[model samples]
Target: MATTILETCRVPAPPGAAANLSLPLTFFDIQWLHFHPIRHLLFYDYPCSKPYFLETVAPKLKESLSLTLRHYLPLAGNLIFPLNSEKKPEIQYVAGDSAVSLTIAESASDFDHLTGNHARDADQFYEFVPEIDPVTDESEYQRVPVVALKVTLFTGRGICVGFANLHCLGDASSVVGFIKAWASISKLGGDEEEFLTKHAESLPILDRSVINDPLGIDTIFWKVIRDVPLKSSSFPLPTNRVRATYILRQADIEKLKDLVLAKKPGLLQVSSFVVTASYVWTCFVKSEEQVDDDDVLQVFIFAADIRARIDPPVPASYFGNCLAYGLAKIEHKQLVGGEGFVIAAEAIADQIKNRLNNKDQVLKGAENWLSETKEMTAIRAFGVSGSPKFDLCSADFGWGRARKLETVSIDGEKHSMSLCKSRDSEGGLEVGISLPKARMDAFAAIFEEGLRF
Candidate 1:
């Protein structure tokens, strides 16, 4: 049988390999690397557990996924394969992790079909769950992906994502490169907005204050950075990228605090970003379309930080959306005013202000929501963005920050953006976008005009 570059693996490490050999990876390999060659594949001997409504799935998924991964990730970094070498394909992985990589059928089409079904199940669950109550309660305004919902995450389903499996090591780029190549993606014009991310070390580094936690999420994050590489990489990618961090500038934060306090005293504690963000989404939708309230102007999906929104913020950053999707639909006539966009944004802003400030509104509401778990299913944010020191440019454990950072939307259509800060503050952000060509043009026109802060 003939072997191609794509099929061969685990050859003896070549002597005198390129000392600083870069990734055997790149982004979304719609070509050679198919959908996640690195399977964080969890197998079950039995059939998938019976389906409960999404209401049942929501509260349990994050906690359960976290718990499941923690058990599997016993060592320092479970999913992360260390490339702590100058050698080509920089070696990484635990003792037997490699054997698991080999335990697969020659054909992956089987896994794809199975997981595809699971993904459809996930979408069906979302379709049935009530659209989150919009300020206008317009069905058209509820948040949802225009195209596809991924069923990859469901247990017992086939593989959807690659963990830092044995063969390739680095980060999400490895995953993307493999998937893009696999899908044989051949678009040349590109969608950088949906694909801008940098390795942490790529940017000029800065110092900041520390937060304490014994076994907390932040601690785990910093742990991931212990030997974080301080260089950068040049992986050419075709996706939007973002970094994850919680550090807000003192001055920027103070300005925000003042804005919140003037609106309602002592209200700076909640995510003021939500207020501004909701305002952004509302205005963005209204400005683009002429559809009426019945037409549903909803687009941006605002994810709630349900933790801080709770009695006190949870000690850890919980994965999965502990968020609520609130839609804002304006009657067509009301939207005809000259300043309708601003007015719509202000209205959304005011709702958030009141909800967050009305005597620990977030906490009380969280408690109430948790109390009524069975009846609270609704569409929520599933995309993730990070500003972690190196989630973008400095994420190099060695090779360098990934050439790109991005989120794989469960929704097949690319309708989201990832915002990463840039030294080019003149532009102020290195925005990696990934919308279809048409939507990309429309969005660029909006930002080029510089929407108000």
Candidate 2:
């Protein structure tokens, strides 16, 4: 776990990238104001010496990142929470003052084991994660960084690229879009103009007017956040946990869907996401081994991209948080019973059909989302991050595509999991899980047994 610091630099948009910009937060963005920043790690296998990496790879990455910032200026900006209640929070950037902190370092850890499918110590990856600076108290506003970047070289092994971004700045879609753009520019020899011409669809639409909040949900969310202690925003420290990756191939997903249909014939939605998530949830609950009460509730939470579901649909490339919540709850006995997977699937399927797919009521109870979630804080509640649609493995920077990718921030949440498209198998889904070593062992056995016909 030893890592040597090379250098830390501030990377700003190249001169004349754009003028000062201010993008206001929508209700979706405001909800995450007090949460920990989302962190991700992309590991690429490249055999090279430290000198070669410093002389060749480092400059290319920094230059391409600067070029990418030109289009995603808000990423290199600050999240400003104004003291005046009337003035809403916003993502602000000053022409010459805004920049992203990039830290370059080298680690002595085993890249293969760290990127392997087997369970490994969750704290091992913490060295590669870069920390975002704490919020500063300005005269009338609190200023905090939107994003911070880190590039860790494994000497003769490979490199790990990491980023930490405030959720209020954007969601997974926006963050992935920026990464793809940066990879393209880096692969094309840092040619910003060429990237713009070839990948015009990748550019982000920064307009905040497209999102309409007719219910004053934003006001309700702001009031809730005002009572929260800002110190709670600090990132979670590593606990005694082990992280692992599991894949549900296309065939496996099909079996799960069939099982759900056999148990509940008229279920409305049995998508891969629902089935896979349900199976995972059931296994996790069973792994606990102590929750035997029939009435105890196990809550499962996940989010959906609402860009296409909105009334006047927002652009797919809109650079902000536009999401709807999907929550499902099942009793302890039902989740740990002989037909746990089927029952969990039915619950999740119904939730998606009644909430997520129902455009008219997608945001129906959003005003109480934060409060309701807080109430479940003491229960056995778990959530999922990322989505298979992101296809994060496809991100390439002239080197080959990422050998492995992880949502490192899930380590901060209690028993949360991450989902993404599989790197080796087409149409397959990858699920990342973190838990105590003993619990992880139990979950692994349950997961494998459930997949067998």
Candidate 3:
């Protein structure tokens, strides 16, 4: 395959170390693939070893060995986690796919090179190697391996710090360039990064047609507000990384259903976005801004399992993008309407019904949000995950069930939000939520109040 020309430069010194691929995540590492270490993990490194990432993508990808693998085949839609939930998740090797089968470990050590079985031993997985700058003799970059251990195993502070992979998965090619640039600087003696980044921000914040939430950043807006998925939108993946997983809880789900019941029927049977909506509002949708008549809008967006919701459930293992929208947008007054929790419940439910039931529309209008090309139109977007056909509750490793599972996200100049589910000490569900620092503080306060109400 041919290569494209990406911007390159000497690595920066001292304060100007080259930026490496910022992605990080330990997929099979946590939740151990449906809570069973026996299941396979298609582990992959950051696609950061390449040069000319921005420019030569087409050529390299054309010549890429994976092209020999198979077409861009979407994974199965109805296939639940743990393949067999009652047991651990395991995938037999299949030929002709870029995705690979993970070899299970008798213990987690199979995944990480660490000493002793100490909780901190997982730290070795995050060991970043430094890249020397081309300009300065100083190593201009340090790409530490990421910590893929369970967040619950760590403090709130630690999970808060695990944003690197999130950034990487969001854009893998960029990750490739970043790491290569760093490697070049670290080993080739160049500026830490293509000088553009160092001088780019200082140059200007160009204003254009793009609009954003009041917070003025894309990630922040996605944090608290729920978003719906586009027809082709992907499940959570890091900015520049490849692997990802989606996990939820059973009991908290019970709490969600109860909240929705106050308003509409067929809710528990509604889309996952519907279930997630109640949690989003109950946790923090209370009038952060109401004076200007701008009632807080919690836009919930996620895919509806169109395959199953319409009628008989799709085959237990049916795969493909058989999903539609569970889109809903509610105003704060209506969300916290005077009628009480019952009122709030009904209003949000009504909002979801309005979207899903409207004009035979599911995305409400988000089509290009997941576009693969620039020519693709950009759809107006809302944040909410669609419902899943797979069983999140049953994802068990040989150890029983995943003690904890989080829909990992990465933070940048902006931030992201994902879900987490931990097994109860007694082997049930314990849900945990993570958002931007600014918002999480507010969420804690609301959780305190939610428990009261």
Candidate 4:
């Protein structure tokens, strides 16, 4: 399958948008300063005329994107580290000219295979993601685009809207909100005024100061990550690594939950997420061969949104990152041994509770934890990205809802998995995981066997 680039252009905010706006980064935003761009793809099947898409649909998408930017002005700007400034870098939305790069392309790939619910090669989705290159000046100050978009028409089958956003700009919730807003506008024929009036309830709060960090977390975060070098290659996964999507049906999820409750009858925190995460973590550990050191620690690192947990709660629609990472650690033997699921679930649930209960302390100690953990070269780490809570399947443009939504960028990273609610919206879950080919096969076996009560 080959993808051909047709055209590339910039889509700026609509007229009368606030000009020369500078939004300071909070500790949550700066914590992910060196992280990779978040890539997401939404595939839609429109078996209609190519002329219809080019002449009608394409123009609406571009126009709607412009209007969407009017509300999300920061996305049209860049993140720059200003020279001689004591404060950390910030997002600057320059008035008239700043815009997001939009690439128009065409692909002849198998649309069904790419969007199918089953597993396929992780690398295949890379072609649909656009490259977001951050430019650096002679003074060594770096300026990076906050977002880039690509629209590809899969000849005679469907179209895909590819998104790439710098993690610092926002979290998954913010990005999905942006996408839904764009789609809503596109469906309404790019009516900016109608979009504003109709979806008035969903407008994002761009102010970042509400997240009062009394502990000076922003400074601590910058100091800790400033020296860590950026990844040399954007595409760092080994060739042998592969990605697959696994489903946890509603019945299976409930069964897992029941199993956890059976072991600990008083366990009130075992939800689908906790149980599913525990199952995956245990399978991952069991798939790997036993290590010489039984005491080696296996860590499960996941993030939680502090939007409503903080003292002065941040708005749900607040734009920018508002997440705190939660870590759960267990010795290798204990993690793979019998009763692993129960132990993992208990630890994860407890950690989550602790994080919420001591939100301030957690935020304050985040940098310190990173500093100490970075030195542990031998510890094994696993993390879960993307959440089922972010109902991505409901993102509907005019034509229809997305056939599939994928987190393609994380596939290249080791021991990282993506989770989202099932497309059917039946209280099930869809998990995208990547591993060495052999380990993936072994993990599949363990995943299936463990669920068979």
| lDDT value for model 2 | 0.88
Of 1 and 4, the candidate ranking higher by lDDT: 4
Model 3, residue 185: C-alpha shift (Å): 43
What's model 1's lDDT at 170?
A: 24
How does residue 305 of candidate 3 score in lDDT? Answer: 39
| Candidate 3 TM-score over all chains jointly | 0.40
Residue pair clashes in candidate 4: none
- Runs in model 4 deviating more than 4 A are 83-85, 138-140, 227-233, 237-239, 357-364, 367-369, 372-378
The Cα RMSD of model 4 versus the native structure comes to 2.1
Model 3, span 1-453: residue lDDT tens: 111112222111122212221111111111111110111111212122123322343233222212211211111001112211122211111222113111111112232222111122111222211111111111321121111211111111111001122121212222222222222232222332343344333221111121112332223222212122112112232323212222234554566566556555655344344455455544555524233564645454443333333333333223122344444446656655543344444545565566544434533333333322121113222343212223232232111232233233221102223333233323122333334344455655665565445
Whole-structure CA lDDT of model 4: 0.81
lDDT for each residue of candidate 2 in 1-453, tens digit (9 for 90 to 100): 499889999999989788899898999999889888898999999888999999999999999999999999999999988875567889999978999999999999989999999999888888998889888877777888899999999999999999899999998899999999999999999987789899898689999888988898888888778654344245566568899999999989988898889888888788999999999998898888675477988999888998988788999999999998887888888788889888888888888888887888887888898887776677889899999888777788987889998888898887799999888877789999999999999999999998884
Q: Candidate 3 regions off by >4 Å?
A: 1-276, 287-296, 310-316, 336-344, 351-382, 385-394, 410-422, 425-432
lDDT of 4 by residue, 1-453 (tens): 599888899988888888778888887888677777888888887886667877887888889998898888999998876544455788988977689899988898999888875556777787888778646553645677888899999878999989988888899889889989989899888877898898888899997777887788788777766665343226554446677778899999988888888899886668788888888999999999668888988898888888888777888999998887777899988988898888999988888777744756556566575564454324688888899787776777786878787887776555778898887648889888877778888988898887775
Highest TM-score: give the candidate number: 2
